[model samples]
Target chain A: MVFTETGTEIALHAGTSCSSGTCGAGIAQNPVQSLTPEDQRMLAAFRPETVEAAVKKTIETYKLFSYTDKILVACSGGKDSTVILHMLKKFGYAIEAITVNAHIGCYTDENLRNLREMCAKIDVKLHEISFRKEFGKSLCYIQSILKAKGYDYKNCHTCGVLRRYLLNKYSKPLHPDVIVTGHNLDDEAQAVMMNLFRGNLQVCARIGPKTGMVHDSKTDHNSATKKKFVQRVKPLYFVRESDVVKYSKLHNFPVYYGECPCSSDTYRREMKDMFKSFGEQRDEVKEHIIKSFISISEPLKAHFMQAEGGAIQECLICGEPSSKDICNTCALLAKLRDNKIIKS
Target chain B: MVFTETGTEIALHAGTSCSSGTCGAGIAQNPVQSLTPEDQRMLAAFRPETVEAAVKKTIETYKLFSYTDKILVACSGGKDSTVILHMLKKFGYAIEAITVNAHIGCYTDENLRNLREMCAKIDVKLHEISFRKEFGKSLCYIQSILKAKGYDYKNCHTCGVLRRYLLNKYSKPLHPDVIVTGHNLDDEAQAVMMNLFRGNLQVCARIGPKTGMVHDSKTDHNSATKKKFVQRVKPLYFVRESDVVKYSKLHNFPVYYGECPCSSDTYRREMKDMFKSFGEQRDEVKEHIIKSFISISEPLKAHFMQAEGGAIQECLICGEPSSKDICNTCALLAKLRDNKIIKS
Candidate 1:
């Protein structure tokens, strides 16, 4: 896990790499023989075996998944998602891949191409849900129309809400035991800091490696909609973004190494910058934040949950389990429809 | 507040200025006649009258002080402390001033002179505590010795610990209702951010406008040292550091404008810089952090306190109340003495 300014290149041990197909016949023959001595040294220090052990530790520590359970890897065709998918497949998890395409022009195309290519190589089925087919309009069209009508929000908010709604709605038939995301250490730390800064404790209570909607056959028996809420996990929770990038590149996954143009979360970007700067001085900055959050998470969750009052309601429009009468997705859609921006 | 890149000069309504003596006979006669229209507008937007109202509101909101209670202002001769002391005095509070002279070369002299002049002008009794006299060594001497021994700590840490120990020990005899320090919004926000970054929850739990030493008379029944612990308050907890500087200058309070030569809290400085940048975009940035912390402080305090467990012991060396057998002050002193650099 050697962090470099220009490029991130992690060196995994030959044994683990071989077992995981990270150093398959193709790469093993070529072996990024171009790595500098410095990079090689860094790679040796943070071997793949070490990173693999950490990933395993995180999974075990959080009880994120079971071997018998069906796992759905949420692939974005990005470095993080691709790396996670590759690792899980190599580790022999009963996993498949899903990509929710926002249909953001060339970016969407690139993502699809890369994702399809990678899935084909790994012999895994790739499932994709597009915004145009599901919502009758591309994310860009909806966002632009809203912007023209003076909507005070970035596209990311709308895209994220729709994507989450679509993921749950579309993945229902799969009956996955868990939904895995590519939320690495950097992303998780940024979220924790953001929630703390915004004084959003209720949201903070919901954050952890294995946190999301927990589907229980007995507890959720009264509400049919609650059954749609699947448990989500993150095997890459302890893995650094740098390590993910290095791993992805080293394995030659067809990853689109570009940021989303609609990444309007300026606050999150600032947090990432802070993490990067602090990480230069100490590598444990991200780990400290995550570990500390875990330590107090139970008490924090209990306190906030008690304050918020546990009352779940089904969204009137979508029949999704929500804290409010209308789910966030339904509320957002109502706003879009009111402005006559998003087509039905 | 109109955060400027070059300087921060706040405007005050003449009415409020007269009461606080900020517009003394000399300044009132001319009234910063050289201030440009832009500066005047900037000042008008962030007037002392408005700031005073906020201070009053915070006091009322937090129940920080009462008219019947005796208050001691911890004056550091800096802008923040000087402004606080002046405001409390003007508000007709039963207040006196205390200045701990760290005896850091010329810096100490400047602080003492300014404190003396301001106290004399305000007709308040000023108490002086010197590290050289009490600790048998100047803070500079102690810090230099510690540094020579490869002790990786900033001078501010040692200074802060010794100053706190002295303030509690000396102010104990006064038996004041509250000891107010000039920790403004910026300082408090920086501390909260630092604690979060450093993963220091126990320290974070001990933060807020009115937080410190909870004096339980029953718990201290058998321990004389425990009785010395006083409740510390910060009236300027909602006030920004820049505003304090402007208020100090406007009031013409004799204040040392120079930063301490040994002010080496790099992390704190970084946080300050971050605040300054964010403040330029949103003046309420500091307020936002403080408010957020306040919202979570109770639960956070409860969670951390339960984890820490309330266990207090008297220091073997100094007989002061401590979490361990040796108090922080004694521990620091022991480290300084270990190198055998301090004179007997």
Candidate 2:
């Protein structure tokens, strides 16, 4: 039996053990002695079966992937992504792992080490990409340069644009049928709210369990670029974040338990706290939010799809799929080069 | 100068004194000694002109009401409603006030007293309705009866349905062009979130500055009943709740500052708190929520309107406008009577 962060003592599976001590070392070191009433209530309600059933149901309902498909799992070295990667491999799928090292101080360094060890143990071929190698600068350095140039975007915003660009660009050579992300229900719900709060319904239209599934065949301008851009699916779309944490602990995954150092975005932190507050009052608040979003998502997609005729455009500089003449990554790169922050 | 709840010291409008003494007695009784950093920042940013400009813009932009229109303001004796009523009268609109006394212990009693005095002071005709005279029981008594019958519903839900029904039914005889409400930006933003969280997009479709403006003339079944149901408009749709409080204090309106005794619903309280948290981070967060909601509200309304053909129906029992054959109020009343909790 091992005590989790919520002070719940969980028994490991009968035959399962962390043969590699690195995987379960973090949990063993930090055995919480006390928990708040809310934590106790949440931990007491944790059911492994419920979480597994949700993942299974999401995959089958959404028809996310097939046995014949070669899946590429994006490992963020966090609990959510690590759990998804392990689950997909255990399910006997043809799978490989890919990660982007943005070099956010010691946070990324520890995560990368943990991810490398975890992948090698599972016998999965792990591919690594780095911000320094690809963009000639670490994410922090790029952010600092941009800040000096008076282009002050949040760290997550800059990193997100770059990471997505790299993931798509690099995955093409691997030729995977689909890219799998570990975005749980909590993440998706937060995204729905953030987009709504930012008046970005068109962006909201592009998210779901099967990302980028909604396409306007007639109006879309870049069918060629669309073919180049692989679809992404989320198997954990219906699972909760706490469930992911519980699953990660139960399986003894070697995952960094800390948040990204640069992810202190006030808006997202506020949203995360808001969800926690709402969840305490209604246990299924996250599920309700996702369900409501899904109900309206189709109409939202259809409306915007038809409204923005010739919606997708190939980036003039990088030849990548974009909503405008230039993709976000290329635009940022152009800004950096124009300010002589980075050599062209 | 008077110190407000947020610890903001404000000078009252020049020559505008609380000569009656009862109007500003609440503020005079106790002054806040200290303020949190958030409260200090919010108070520092208070501009009465900005609030007035928003209200004026909402009225003009939405074409909510005209000078010739007979406006019946729904006065709840709360700061929001009181401010809206005073603003409309000051704007030179022909206005009167109507209030419902739910008899929620001392809360509604005090509110009713304040409503009467404020209406008399403003030289507006005051119309009062009571649950005992209209429904044969007070709201609290009815709630207890329903709870005893094992039909437990939140007080706000029950009260909202009955109050809306009474407002429409009673306002018809007043021959007003429109029934004005005090739903401000914060309230509307909360409703948007609540409806989204509850997966009640159909209900969300019916809300806006000009409530119930989205109608399908071809598909609507109850044109006659609709005519009987006076439309409700919100002139303070763009104003913030805090601004409403400031406006009320500025004018020294006699208003009850406490919340309704029956309004301890956890879901709404959570939403309100979430907005407050978001507002602390971004001052225009509420505005963004409302703007995003408005952008998609038209499509939301249009989609649901067409989907729900014959959208409006006259309640079979009461002949009031409803979305179903039997209205919520009648359906609830039927349950109470059928359980023998309340005499028919």
Candidate 3:
């Protein structure tokens, strides 16, 4: 299996054997083959052509404000993020990439190196931040502590807290009018589940193309800030995950187009597999979910506005806006540092 | 620990001495007994009395609604279901217990026996439906086929689909105004996870206090000659799982309170554990989730109603409404009778 310049062919690996059991490796098996019917149907025949189309379509679809403002792209160095960075740059959005490295051993090592290499190739400015530099210890250290103390949490907890912190920290200095996240519709749907499961309605309300719960001063981390929330937008909110994969391959982006090793140990990975196993039925299901989110969001928001709960408090440790005195990230870091097991 | 005359408490387990890597099991190692107020406040106190209070409060808070019309109560003889049946009878709702016997070895046998005994003791009419009679094969037989073919589904899949069928069949004959389910908040929250993960928004939309999306004849089954949809209601929507356990104990109702042995092999159990570990934080999360569901549900419903492309089609053989030509229940039976495995 080889990929030609076009990177077209072999979309559905159904009847045939994808010995590796991964969509990326399987699809890329014979990238040189002529586009299959399924590939043609998805218009992924011209991988390079289709990716550009999706990015262009996404931009056109969202009809965002002028690209003249400072556009910051959150780069995880993964396929989706790389593709997003490339797409933004291609579309001539005044964009710069920011990567938050949690220093999670083998996981972040390859990703960070690949991201730095991509930035060098594309000649884009990249900002890097590490968890220890800001919070005093690595996430693995913190997770071990939490585990020992009987407060077992998933790795996503550490990743989420740090990533969010970095996003805010980076955005604050640059003061971008809007921050662009590589959150595709599927990612948004997943977040909807996380938010729904966590019962964090107010935070979820501000998760769409626009960001933040209310337009009140409580959400604004800085009093001198232009707006209460830093208008986070999703350019690829409507783009499919498969299309993103095609685009990454076509654009010759350096992305670790595979699931994180630890992710398989999670229930979410089970859901992801379920989604992957489901043939074509997923698009409609996702569309329904997005529309569902759109349905009660306004009423729920209004209810929140009418509620008597106080405004978001500033985290005493980090100054990030939080419902509690300490922010989630800081708390996570502290727990990690405190919980080191002296295994002799 | 000695149980009172009321059949709630019991004398603590005597002669327990074991050493697991995490914690040693001994009366001296009991944290509650060892710790003073300061140290104890830091850890969770699993008090039976507090659990009882929480359970009682949970039910009373939401049991305000008392339906005078005919109500069909779904019973599994499990702790949650039995407790619900007891509560509904106590509340004096015009209701009867309906159980679907999936015919899985000792599980369903014990379930039926326990359910029958409870109904006899409580003097309530118990309606039992068997899958072997209805579909011609036991659930255990169905499960073997699904597992052999690597269907990548849980036991809950067969049971869930079969339960819905049985509920409708029983509810239709009775012409019950509402089908009352023992779907407590925890179950609802987990369901919300399942629906979102699979992007089954229409089903989620169908999931509310009393209304579900069944208007579409192609996707949702219309079995009753009188009504197209069963007006389903949850009297225990706000009830907590811990409370349900406590309530079951307090009432001394004969129930198989332990979890379904099969649930341990499922992904949902993982989710349940994740939620359980959150402790009190779990409720805040559930409230936010309920709010989120209630938030965009209506507009999302309209979105789905407007663009709902597929419809539930009736099975050609059994004439049950199904998404495919054959209903899932029928498909299970067919699979059990034979060994061919091609997912529709």
Candidate 4:
């Protein structure tokens, strides 16, 4: 896959082929890419049995999902998501895949193609959504319009708000029991630290393997009021990012190794870098952080829930599940429309 | 003063003289040392009026102490402690000073001399204690003995345990209402992060401008049960370390700029460096962390106190205040005695 400098132009290219060149004619071939020395070292140290066991254990421990439940995997064509997808399929869980084509140049194009190929190979259904189709403009175009109109939001901020909105809106039709994402231990740890550093303790309460506010004893899980938002779970919550990469490489899974081209989230990046440097000195620092977070998550959730009155409201503008009268998506869209950056 | 490589030998010389060389003979002479370029820049940017107001505000807001209260300042001859001690004296708070001579080579020797000179200049009574006089050996000697006996404790650990024990024991006779330390914002932030990172939420609860577990609603502050440990407070709790350095340099306080020679607390050093780097990108990151910590500290302290039974115990051996049956100092001394490193 190739990306333009501005990430505004899409470049079409042939798909990656199996580099090992040893798959039989009848078998579904995977794109086996060359591994860097570091990748090779990690791959050598990767214990597939142990990693598989850990993933399964996390799923079981968290009661993430059952084999009978319909699981929708949020695939970004990244190593983490792709590994989880394949693992779930191999474990015989009824699953489907979904991807967002944010029109981020050739990046999303290649990711979407890889998603299609992997889903087809695994005999799972794939759902694709695009910003241009849904919002009448590519993500880059909307970002440019917002920038031209003096809105100073970062690319990741806009992308995250829109992508999350689309994921929830589009997945509602599928009626899956739970939506699964490929967030790993490192990602979860970063989220915990970022929320704390930003002084967003209430937000911190709404994160874990199963994301959301803690349910009070008074709230009924099966009540009609709780059905607006689909629950999200993470099976790979215990797996490290490096381990995911190593597992993906070991399995010759076609995945993108680079970060999002337009990602300018310096704070999160700094946190990631900090963890990397700290992890070098101490093994399982990320694990320690996540474990510590889990220990306090209950009280954190309870305190914040009580403080905020613990009600999930429907966005007045879009009727989506929100913590406020208007959801972040509807709010951002309103700003864009007010400035004539997007159609009303 | 100079510290040797092993930090086991003292090489003291004459005291620092005022570098500006403009002090009139009758005035108390301050050892005005040469400032680094960075220090000069900080000094130039230092707003003495604003800083003094902030310190005064923090004291009044926290009710740290009053003019009528007897304040015992923990003077280490470092920039932080020296500044706080001087500030308290200048503010007309009834204050005395105390120092712990750990005998960390020429480091403590120079600090001791500086402390004496500063106290004499300010007309505050000074009390001094030493490891050699109290424990029959210098700090280095004890650390060496522990190392030789395969105790594997870090120098900072041993020094901290012994120094804290000595401070509480020696300060008892002074009968001060509160013991004041020069803990700045950066130090408190680091302590918060370190405790959280180490999963010691209980320890984090025991820290703030006024350090201790939260007093339960039923417990009376005036009760004899709470009198075992002297209440410790920090007037410089909201001030940044850089500002403290600038304030110290601006006043030409005879303070040591370097860290302790025997310091090997890498975890804390890393936290400090992390804050420095983060501070470069975003101003007041430390303040944010500290403010957020304060918001949750009450719950943290209350929860931990309830879980731990909320009782301060008298050390079985030393009759000192401790959370455990035996104080850390008594336990360490026992270890040393058992190994024949110290007399029983």
Measured against the true chain A, the candidates' chain A TM-scores are: 0.79, 0.80, 0.71, 0.82
Mark the 10 consecutive residues where model 4 chain A has the least summed lDDT.
A18-27
Residue A33 lDDT, candidate 4, scale 0-100? 41
Interface RMSD of each: 2.2, 1.8, 5.5, 1.6
Q: Per-prediction DockQ scores?
A: 0.34, 0.48, 0.21, 0.47
Q: Which of 1 and 4 is ahead in lDDT?
A: 4
* Candidate 3 docking class: incorrect
Order the candidates by lDDT, highest first — what do you get? 4, 2, 1, 3
Q: Judge candidate 3 at residue A95 and give its lDDT.
A: 82
In candidate 1, position B9 carries an lDDT of 21
Candidate No. with top DockQ? 2
Docking quality (DockQ) of candidate 3: 0.21
What tens digits encode model 3's per-residue C-alpha lDDT throughout B1-344?
23344534221322232111111222122223544464344333445455435435544553423556777778887777787777667656677888898755455556677789888988889888887677655655556546657765668877786677667766787887767677777888777766664545455655555543334454444344225447666666666676676566545556554455455566577557656665567776666666567665664555455554543334665554334677666776566456632222
Question: Which candidate has the highest TM-score of all?
Answer: 4
Number of backbone collisions per candidate, in order? 2, 0, 24, 0
Which candidate leads the pack in lDDT?
4
- lDDT by residue (tens digit), candidate 3, A286-320: 55666556655654454454452533445566544
Model 4 regions lying over 4 Å from their true place: A1-41, A212-228, A281-283, A309-330, A339-344, B1-45, B212-228, B281-283, B305-331, B339-344
